[model samples]
Target: MDARTQWDAGRSEEWADVTPDAARRLLTAAVQAFAERGYHATTTRDIAGRAGMSPAALYIHYRTKEELLYRISGIGHRLALGIVSRARDGGGDPAGRLSAAVQDFVRWHAEHHTTARVVQYELGALGEEHHAEIVALRRETDAAVRSIVEDGVAAGEFDVPDVRGTTRAVLSLCIDVARWFREDGKHTPGEVGELYADLALRMVGYAHK
Candidate 1:
């Protein structure tokens, strides 16, 4: 069987028997283990232990470590894309939309640091076919950001000379925050969001009103 087909077959079982809260806890533990130990080093037993569940219990939810990692990484990208999509759909001036998008991205990364870290650092551990699926999702995210920037530039709200490069810079800046931001840091997540929104606006030449 092909890799994609094999993956689909493996994931075809219904997990409706698992409670939403239990699944969330499992995903949380998986994210922490994947971030701290990396995909290759993280074992299902480690995630199960951290989540206070037995390995068999975890297996009832997820078939393997790879499946857990795949789900986390895939969800991270989807969440980011959803934020941008919603911001665009809100119907505002270019600057307002851009500010909202940046804030949303920053806040999401701060709130889901473990998932962000795994998505950023451990994606390579996915099998090649699964990696391609995630790569496409990431590309869609990049495209969405670029489209926002391009729209702003065309609308005369932003003065960036290179929309693509600016999009990458903005994304990188927000994604890296998951690496260093601490709950007890000098600035709260809201403060970080505001700061990043300001910086992103300035990068695109949108002066604060």
Candidate 2:
């Protein structure tokens, strides 16, 4: 399949760092299966089959289904956190940085909606320890956005009354794109990102012009 098809089908190169071709294949297959059937419903055998491997091969790569979920969650969440953190640290004024953060964050979710769906929605299926780790990463992501809002407020560039709530609301708006975005949708990922960025700026009471 073409790269686009692979990505839309959840076989994205987002996990290209995963070692060994077989392991990457399994990771890709696991993402596809989990995104489609959910972590609780998807089986190791199913993932193995999708990767064109025997079930035993799955064991060699990943100890259990939850391990696959943990791997996926860790990678995806870190990627998301990096996106927001870069915008937070990037050289820009508060409004500019906030807009960049929301725009890029939303674009990633829309473009990688399939992977994002599994990453954002399948956390509950992770083991307790794994869940905690993911939660910590999520908190960092929240902090990244909150820091931008705080900066905006401090700079008098935004009129947010509740920085924490507004930060979450912004994240929620961007993250939800994964649940609903489609390649064939009226808006391309970039368009959705631009639109959401504008809305986010408005939410902060910034007169982005």
lDDT by residue for model 2 over 11-114, one digit each (tens)?
35588789999999999899889888888888899999999999998999899999998998999999999999999999789989999999989988988888
Which residues of candidate 2, in runs, are more than 4 Å off?
1-11
Q: State each candidate's clash count.
A: 0, 0
Candidate 1 lDDT by residue in tens digits, 1-209? 64334323423221223357677788878877888888888889999999999999998889988999888888778878888888776788878887888898887777666667888888888888889999998888888777878888888888998888899999899999889976656776667889999999999998559
Specify the poorest-scoring 10-residue window by lDDT in model 1: 7-16
Estimate the TM-score of every prediction.
0.85, 0.94
Error of 2 at 126 (Å): 0.7
Error of 1 at 67 (Å): 0.5
